[model samples]
Target: MIKITYKMKSYRENLKDIIQPDDTIIELGCHVGKSSQFMLNRIPNGNLIALDNSPEAKSKMDKLSFEYKNLSFLNSDVRLHESLKKVKEKIDKCDILSVDLGGGYHPDTTFKVYYIWSSTFKPRDSIIRNRGLIDFINTATSNEDMHSENGFLDSCGDMGIPPQIKEFKLWSEKI
Candidate 1:
């Protein structure tokens, strides 16, 4: 259900802002290991926990881990707290937690990056975001998805104003 679009550049920079040698990463939907691979290469001293419900995730990560020394893969569904418990034991307060799998694309493909991140990371330490439309296009295609950029900015605009997307225009002027 998870679709992978590797927006390697933005993703890498985003990770760089927060990822440190001491930090660990937990990607909710590893989907063919695109983000996993990107983030893996970035943090050589740190470790990445890649999780996915798809059968391919295990095999792909197994192959990928061979190249990256600090990577591990787990076959787990982020939706199920029970499934997440063991992974939680290994990685909580992950430096980066991305919800890139869920959407109309995948029904149960980690629809709650916010909730999981809220529970997993300290409020001050957490830097979590969802990879819905913008992230997906940016990740899947080899080019920058301008639509996603606008969408993300538009979303932030909504966050700024009447607290509704309809009021997004109001925030644009404030910015």
Candidate 2:
């Protein structure tokens, strides 16, 4: 077993709490498979669909694929609607969904992809990076802020998903 740092150790433990042995998981922005490896360790009989736009990340994931039979890597831009749609088609549903697109910018593209893809499966549990979560909640809740925030939220509103937000502390430590 790999020894994770304290922060990651707690995050992994939180994930393990929500993830079942046979639950399917879809992770967006799976850079070099750090989280993927942790998730793979938990789901022995389940499946993991990891997506990333970086060729280097894909290369690393490709190597890890040989070691993990339950993992599948999709080398594509998660911000693209077409790419997300394609993934949604492949795995109709999953028990857990994790999003960590990094950069802390492009909330529009990030939430757009997340909203669209999440609508397909509607996983019971979703873990999003703090910035993404804040952006999503802010846009979803207040209409006035929606106009000023970004066009993606307006677009999401047009799709008709109600603004029902719930907050929770899933992990004790920040990653």
Scored by TM-score, the top model is 2
Candidate 1 wrongly placed segments (more than 4 Å): 1-9, 102-113, 123-175
Clashes of each: 5, 0
User: Each model's TM-score?
Assistant: 0.58, 0.68
lDDT of 2 by residue, 62-135 (tens): 98899999998999886554565666677767777777776364566555555655655566676655354465
The models' CA-based lDDT, in order, is 0.54, 0.65
RMSD of 2: 10.9
For model 1, the local distance difference test gives 0.54
Per-residue C-alpha lDDT of model 1 across residues 6-94, encoded as one tens digit per residue: 35565455556655665577776677887787777677787887778888788888898898878877787655555556665675456
Locate the minimum summed-lDDT window of 10 residues in model 1: 166-175
Candidate 2, lDDT over the whole model: 0.65
What pairs collide in candidate 2? none
**Which is the leading candidate under lDDT?**
2
* Cα shift from native, residue 135, model 2 (Å): 7.8
Task: Point out where model 2 deviates above 4 Å.
Answer: 1-13, 103-106, 135-175
In Å, residue 106's CA in model 1 sits off its true spot by 8.6
